[model samples]
Target: MNAVLRVAALGLGQLVAIGLLLFVSAGTVDYWQAWLFLAVFAVTAWLPSIYLQITNPVVLQRRMKSGPVAEGRTVQKIVMLGLYGSLVAICVVGGLDHRFGWSAVPAALCVIGSALAGAGLVVTVLVAIQNTYASTTVRVEAGQHVVSTGLYGLVRHPMYTGNVLILVGLPLAVGSFWALAFVMPGIAVLATRIHDEEKLLGDELDGYREYTQKVRSRLIPYMW
Candidate 1:
C-alpha cells in the first residue's frame, strides 16, 4: 500500500476503536462540539507523524529493520492502548451524563478539571517541540543518534513525560471521578513503557547509560 494510504488506514482504525468506546459508553448520545475537539486532538497528534513517515519511509524502514534492542514488553503497549480506549469511553459517558442532566460535577471542579487538562496538553506540545525528530515507531534511522540535549538534557524520556501529562489530563477533560480514576492506570502504563524503553536504550544505544547517569530522572527535575 502507498504509505499515505497505509497511515490513513491506521488513522481510521484508531477512529473506529475510539468510536466503539464512544458508542458503548454514550449509548447514542452525541456531543458535536466536544467530539469535534476530540477529533482535532487526534488529527493534531497523528497527522504530522503520518505525513513525516510517509515522506521519509527510508527513515522508518531503517528503524523497523534494525535489530530489536531487546524483547519489548508489549504488555505496556496493550495497557496504554486500553487506557486510551478508556479515556474515550469516559469522555463519551461524561458527555451523555451532561446531555441527560445526570452530571454531578460542581462548577469549581469543572474549572479545576479544565485547568489540568489544558496544562497537560501544553506539556505535550512542549515535549513534541523538544523532540521533534524522534520516530513514532521503535526504530533507529541511518543518521539518527541519541539525543541528549534540549529536554533530554534533563530527563531521558521527555516524550514519555508528555504522554503521562496528556493521559492524566484526558480524564480531567471528561470531568468525572470515574474518568479521573483512569489516570492511575495511565501512570502505571507510562512507568512500564519508560522502564522497557530504558532497558532497550541502555542495551542498544551507545552512551545511553552515561546519559541516564547524567540526567538521573525520567520525568521530574532533580528528582524522579
Candidate 2:
C-alpha cells in the first residue's frame, strides 16, 4: 500500500484496538470514557503520523515497520507484549471501574489527566520529529544516530517517557483508579526496555555513548 493508505490503515487499526480493549475491560460499548480515549488517541497519534508522512515519508514508513529482527531480543518483545497487555488492562480496568463505580475519580482529575495525556501525545509527536529511527522495536536502524536535541537533550528516551505519561494519564482520565494499579507493570516493562535500548544504542549507534554521558538520565529528568 501507499504511504497515505498505510498510515490510514494503521490509524483505523488502532481505533479498533482501542475499542476492543475498552469493550473487553468494561463489557459495554456505550462507555463515554472509551470514546474519549479513542478521540484522544486518534488526535495524538495520527497528527504526528500525518505530519511525518507529509514532511518525512521515509521516517513515517520506518515507524510503521513491523517484522522480526535478529535473535536474542525476544524477551523485549515479550515484555513489550506484556506492556501492551497492561495498556489493555488499563482500558479494561478503566471501563470496569467506571461500570462498577470502583473509582471515585473526580471529574476534575479526569480533566487534568486528559490534559496531561494530550500534552504527552504532543511530546510523542515531538519524539517522532526529533528522532528519525524511533521505531516501535528496539533495534538500531541503518541510518539511526544520536538525537541529542530538543526533548532528547533532556532524556535519552523521551518517546518512552511520553508513552508512560500517555498510559498513566489514560487510567485516571477515564475514571479507572483500580486500573491505575495495573500501570506499574507497564512502567516496569518500559523502564527496562529503555535500559535495553540504550545498551544497544551505546554498543551499535555512534555518538550514543557520548550522548548518554551528556544526558545522564533515561526517562525522568535529573532523577533517572
Candidate 3:
C-alpha cells in the first residue's frame, strides 16, 4: 500500500512539474492549448499507471526507480540523461514558443497531436501489460526472458516507438510548431539507447538473440 501511494505521489509530482514548466516558461496561465494538452496527457498517462500498479506492481516498482541515477550502465546513464534533458527542453521550448508567438498551430492540428500523444501512451501501457519485465532502465532483471509475443512480435522496441510518437506529438499539441525541433534530440538518444540495449540483451539475456532475428525491426515495421 505504501508503495502504491509513493507511485501515485510520484506520478502526480511529475504531472505538476510538467505543468509548472509549461506555465512558468510561458509567463502566463492563459494558454488553452497547453491546458488541453496537459489534460489529455494526464488522463492517458496516469490512468494506465494506476491500472498497472494494481495488475503489475513489480513492473511499476521497477519503473519507479528511473532517471540517470537508476541506470546501472554508464552508457545507459548518459543516454537517460540525454533523453531526460531533451524532454525538458521540449516543454521549455514549447512554452517559450507560446510566449513569443513563434508558431501558430491550428486548433485541428493541436487536436490531432493530442490524439497522437494519447495513442502513444496507450501503446506504452499495452507494452507493459504484455511484458512483465519492461523496466524503465535498460537492464535485464533476474529471471527475465525474451518477450516475443504481442507488441514485441511487431517491433523489438515498441516502447521506443511509443516514445517517438510522444516526442513528436508534445510540441504540436502545445500549439508550437517551432518546438518540434526539440524532438529530434530525444529520438536520437532513443536510437542510441536502443543500439546499446540490444547489444546487452543479445549478450546477456537468453534467447534474446534469436528473438531479435525473428523480430527483425526495432521501432518500425517493413522499413526499419
lDDT of 1 by residue, 58-105 (tens): 444332221123224465456556656556556766656655656566
Worst 10 contiguous positions by lDDT, candidate 1: 62-71
List TM-scores for all candidates, in order. 0.68, 0.90, 0.96
lDDT for position 119 in model 3: 82
Q: Relative to the true structure, how large is the alpha-carbon lDDT of every model? A: 0.58, 0.78, 0.86
Q: How high is the lDDT of residue 216 in model 3? A: 94
Give the TM-score (vs. native) of candidate 3.
Answer: 0.96
Candidate 2 residue lDDT tens string, 1-224: 37777787788888898788777767877777667767877787876786688789877766666433422498677777777788778887787787788889877888777777777888877887787777767787676677899998999888788888888898887887888887788889888888777788889999988887899989989999
How close to the true structure is residue 73 of candidate 3, measured as C-alpha lDDT? 91
Which parts of model 1 have CA positions greater than 4 angstroms off?
58-71, 74-144
For model 3, how does the per-residue alpha-carbon lDDT over 1-224 read when each residue is reduced to its tens digit?
77667767877898899899899999999998888877887788876677678878877776567889999999999999998888788889889999999888999998888888888888887887888898788888789999999999999999889988889888888888888888989999999999999999989999998998898999988767
| Better candidate by TM-score, 1 or 2 | 2
Best by lDDT: 3
Which candidate leads in TM-score?
Answer: 3
